[model samples]
Target: MSGTVGPSAAQKRNYYLIVLSMISMFVTTSTIYMVFPLFFEEYGMSGTSIGFLISVGTFAGIVSSIIAGKYSDSHGRKPILFAGVAIYAVVFFLFAFMEKSFTMFAILRFIEGFAFYMTPVAITTMVADIFPPKQRGKAMSLYTMS
Candidate 1:
């Protein structure tokens, strides 16, 4: 029971997973939104359409977050998280190859909103699960920075 001198391998793994989750969250979210305006503008989308597109994602995110957050508590965080991330990637890959179809983009964005919001709740909870209560705040802060 006295082999290691510093943090255990498990702790290192947990930290690594937490960091990965945070990065995935930021990367997926930022990539979609950061290019939204330029992408839409190229097609001459009106202001109202742009507004509606943004709202569609936001509203879907809210609903997805609520549903996933509640389920994660009873079922467990990791499964939901993995499913969300996997589905999110598939959605993005599909989006990348999609033609200039606004309707398809809108649907994908709705699914994206659902998949994206599901992760933060799970990853945050996993961080809390991995760290002590006193350390959770700092862990969460590190996660949020991503």
Candidate 2:
């Protein structure tokens, strides 16, 4: 109860966590999204098929966001964050082994989308909990920027 109080320590920690979360988000999203265009020709995925691949991931992310947000609101942020990151790691590992099959790649991307959604929601909730109302806007903006 005697430790550092109010915005100082919390703000510093929240800033750091926000930065970490942003980096994680960017890396995860870019890794999944960027590869499609880079190797679509080699993979033989037509523009429509590539769009489907991206759409599946995005749809999964939307679903995951809804579920993760509710769970985090009820349970807490750390567990959701850990689970998301863990699943993300697993998905990336799986993606590394993707063969010529478009179906398998689509499935991997969808799962990755789900996992990626959890991290951002959890991190944003964590930031909201840590920062004051007046500062949350700035914190969220910074989180998005970085």
Candidate 3:
């Protein structure tokens, strides 16, 4: 056996739970990335328009990630994580059924970015909380692998 002790079972469980959430986040994001370009083009958005829309979403994510990190620090990470996931789910569902328009899509994409980003902020916090500093790097590596 190795000299170094490993994480306790509960620690392992929590770590996996966090990883699972990250995986869910990745899945939703990947699905959007795969589908949205085609959908936008089919909806008659020009190449520039599609690029602009994606940029708006990215900007929203950047802004929201900053806000969310502070909010989660004060209010706690779990609520932010759950709200982000919930909002993302709702937005993704709406995308499937909603009618198309540039304005509407832009608004949804903004919300989607805001929601999509909240998870990583809160999740990284949660991982920090669950794992001791010694294991944190490994935990994050596994988290990102999702």
- Against the hidden reference, what TM-scores do the models get? 0.85, 0.85, 0.89
lDDT for each residue of candidate 1 in 83-132, tens digit (9 for 90 to 100): 78887889888977888878888898888878888888888777766666
Index of the highest-TM-score prediction: 3
lDDT of 2 at 110: 88
Every model: Cα RMSD to truth: 4.0, 3.3, 3.5
Model 3 agreement with the true structure over 67-100: per-residue lDDT tens digits: 9999999999989988989999998888888787
lDDT digits (tens) for residues 1-146 of candidate 2: 12333467766776697687669768766776677576688887788998898799899999999999999989998888889888988988887777878888888888888988888888888777777777778878888876
Candidate models: Cα lDDT each: 0.80, 0.81, 0.85
Worst 10 residues of 3 by lDDT: 1-10
* Model 3 regions lying over 4 Å from their true place: 1-8
Candidate 3's clash total is: 0
lDDT score of residue 57 within candidate 2? 86
